[model samples]
Structures are given as structure tokens and as C-alpha cells.
Target: MAAQGDNRPIGVFDSGIGGLTVARSIATSLPHESIYYVGDTKRCPYGVRSESEVRSFVLQAGRWLAAHDIKIMIIACNTATAAGLKIAQQMLPVPVIGVIAPGARAAINSTRTRKVGVLATPLTVRTGAYTRAIRDLDAGVSVYGCPAPSFVEIVENELATGAHLQERWLQDGDVFDTPENREEVARTLGPILEPGIGIDTVVLGCTHFPLLVNPIRHALGEGVRVVSSAEETTRELTDILVRREQLAEDDVVPEHRFATTSDNIAEFAAAGSFIFGQPLKSIEHISLDELDRY
Candidate 1:
């Protein structure tokens, strides 16, 4: 007799709506599985927070999700992963995965010139996680870390609003293509885009970065390949589930649940809907106090 499939939902958490990128990819890759996503929007942009603070927040989120009976937990924020992955793996009851290693692996595979650039949060770059992961995979390859501190703000505050929510921005009049945004992106990415860099591939080290891919690609030019861990991370999740016989059965009808720490559910829903590529019918607001109880 074959083993029965596990129907428990996957838990994914990020500093803000950025994790929806990873969650969306997982939903597409594993249609039968449900997902429980937690976005700590109130304390978002974890990129700037101290490592200790980020780790504490990550654990709180992980514990809260684990308490809800999730089979696996994914730290979808690059900063959270860099700061808390090891400790989360030690403390969480279920399997815990983060975006960093998978993203580093994807960057390594995408680079033809063996010179890769990483665009991530200040904390993520400061941690040297990507450089360590990439070099561990291939010591011959060179990894350059570039901190784009304002990129997260651009995604969460700018792109998630106004015309961007309508999907029109994705068409010819991309929001990232605006003069102001173009100048900002160019300025922020100048270090990596420098001629001497000679990087053939760049990794979107933060989940939020993928949403700004159009502008990032434009700045990097046609010669550079951009990589995100959304697909690679989902692949790792699939393999883990298969090995543990926890893959959801084909007959399972998946349900996705969204929760946010933000006080305004409407705004979170709107931004989330845009990021998740679907209408978010319901979203629960979770407070830091409530999360602390877990």
C-alpha cells in the first residue's frame, strides 16, 4: 500500500508582502498544497534592522506559524534568512527552509562569466551569507555584494500602489520605467552596473527585488542575467516533500490564507493581490502582542 499524502499547509513568512513572491511560486509549482503566509508589515523592511532584532522577529513568526500546524516553514525574507535561519531550524518543530542558499545556487548556475553580483538588503549583504554560499558551491566563482537599501521601500511603498495595482504598470508604461524611478534604480545599482564589474548574472537576493526586475534588468542591460530563488526554492520544497512523503494528494483542493501585522487590511490586501497575482478575498490582521503569545 502506498503512503497517504500529507495535507498540512506550508508556512511562509516575510518582513512584509515580499514573501508573496515565494508563496506565489510555490502555489504555482505545487497546486495541491495549501499555504499560510504571514507578512509582518508593521515591522517591515527588516533589511535595516539589527541581526538580533531580525532573528527575534523571525522566530516569533516561525513559532506562530508552527503553532498553527504547518508541516514546513519557509523564511521568505532574505534578511530574516540571513539572521535567523540556523536558530529557526534548531527551534522550530517542522522543517525550515530559507531563500539564501537556494538563491545563491541559482546565481551560481546562471553565471557564465563566473562573476556574479548580488542585490540585497544592507543586513543581508553585511552578513556575507550569499558570498559564503556561492563560494561554498564554487570557490572559483567571484561574488560581489551590493546593498540596495532603498529598493525594498520602492517595492512596498511605491510599486504596490496607484497605477501599479491595476496591472497597467506591467504593460508598456511600467512604473519602474518612470524617470524618477529610473534615476533611483540606476543610482542604487550603480556599483554593480559599473563596467569593471563584468558580471554576467545578478541575483535578486531579496524577494522584493523580483518585483523590480524590469528596472533592474534595464539598468543591468541585456548582457546580464537576473536570477531569483522563487523557482529554485520551490524546487527544494518539492524535493523535501517528496522525500518525506508529505506531498499533497492530487485530489486536494488548496486554500491559501494571508495574515499581516499591518493595521490596514485593505492596503495589505490590495498590495498582496498585486503581488500574489490574484484577488485576496480575506486577510487577518495579527498584532505583535498576539504573535508573542505563540
Candidate 2:
């Protein structure tokens, strides 16, 4: 809750640049508030890590945000949210929100056939996090899970627009992040997505998956609806903030700050601009070594 003299910005962090998707949604949805976003680029993919490691990584980011005096914290990464939302919320004094619940709720609400599909990282699938969340929300709903480690590669390589996504994502045998492998990756994942006889709604369970939503939608066709956590998470945050009186009242032009654990300014700027749909500013680099000490 925004206490006395508490106009501090909301702090958001993810395992990597993909959480920019969530930051962008909040920036547009709640334009008056300031947001501080951090991407753990050095540990780009947290989905495959152990639960303890994920908890530690998430708390490190959370504690940093708390020290910065943020009134609210957003675990923008789905994997992080799946791994650490409950503990982080209990540990933190302020309101902490994540993407999974909202997205799961939205998926349950949107599926007319009660059959839902989830495309996520190997960690998300292995954790069975999304499946459990959706089932807990509505036992009537069925969730199908797909692990997508390749999606990260496509984003990392900045090759989503071309055929390269196919080779890197589906085939599962390549060390290269190039256009030449896209077809293989696409074909590898295509069989599951090709006109599924069961699922009517598909969930993009990873932050990186949203970057591939267009092609994914194409592959699944109009019958299988797609759900992403971005907009839903923003909406959920807004509701919670309003209830808690943490939402800003005025329509002030908002300022956004972006940071990363790695010193890759160009990659940060590129992905951030695409998500924010504007020229991103205030990009900073802070390593885990320094962050861990605090």
C-alpha cells in the first residue's frame, strides 16, 4: 500500500527480456504510474532451473526492488511466478502480483470447450505449474502442456519473423540460432499444434512464447484460441491496486525505467522498443554479483 510520501514506482523483474511484454502492458494500461523493470539477462532462462535456485533468483530480484522502495512488485516472468509468487508475496510487505493466476483464470474463462493447451518452457511443463493452476481454478477445464525451450532460442537470436524459428524450436538437435533451422523446429512442434482434435484454447505459458503468437496462431488456426499473460496480468494488477488504494489518481504522463543483469544495451533496447511500442529510455546494467551482495 502507498503509505505516507509513498509515490515510489512499481518494480517489475523477469528472468530475461521477455518480461518486457508485461512491463509494456502495465505502462499502457496504467499510464500515470512509474515502473522500474529489470531483466536478468545473465540468467536468461530460469524456467529449467531447480525450484530452490528459482526461489533464490526471484527473491534476489524482489529484495532489490523492495530496497528501492517500490510499493508493488511484479514477477513478470511466468516461470518465476510459477516458482516463487506465493513465497515472495508472504516474504514481502507490499502487494506482489504475478502473471500465472490471471492468465490461468483468463484461459479458464475463455475456453468454451473446456479444453485448453499450454505452450511453455521445459521447466514450466516439468513443474506442471500451469496445469495445476488451471485445474485449481476450474476442475472442469482441461489443460494440455507443451514444453518449448526453442522459443527462447528464437527470441535470443532475434529470428522470430523468419523460418529460422522452425529449425531451432522443434527439431531439438541444433546448437545454431539461425534461419536455416527454422523449418525443422517448426515441423517439430507442428504435429502437436496441427488442428488438434481436443483443445479449443491454447495458452502461451512462457514470456518468450508471446513473441511467437502470430505463427503459433497460424499453426493452430481459428479454432484453437490463444491466451497470453500480458494483458490479463496488467488487468489483475490494476484491480488489486485499486482495491488496495495503491493506484495513482491523476493522469500524469508516466516515466518507465528498464534494467538488466547483463550489459547488453542493444538487445535490451531492441526487445524493449518492440514491446513498449515506443523509444525505451533509462536502460541500466547491473550484474548479479553486485546485486547478490545487497
Q: All candidates' TM-scores?
A: 0.96, 0.86
Local accuracy by lDDT, each model: 0.89, 0.77
lDDT of 2 at 177: 29
Residues 1-294 of candidate 2 have per-residue lDDT tens digits of: 452223568899888878888888888888788898888988877877888888888888888888878889999888898888888998977789888888898899889989888888777777788888899999878777777776776666663233343344456533342344445446645646655447888888887777666567656766778889989999988877776777764755567788888676765676567656676678888887877875
List the candidate 1 regions with Cα displacement exceeding 4 Å. Answer: 1-4, 159-164, 167-172
Candidate 2 — what's its lDDT?
0.77
Worst 10 residues of 2 by lDDT: 159-168
Query: Who wins the TM-score comparison?
Result: 1
Per-prediction tally of clashes: 0, 8
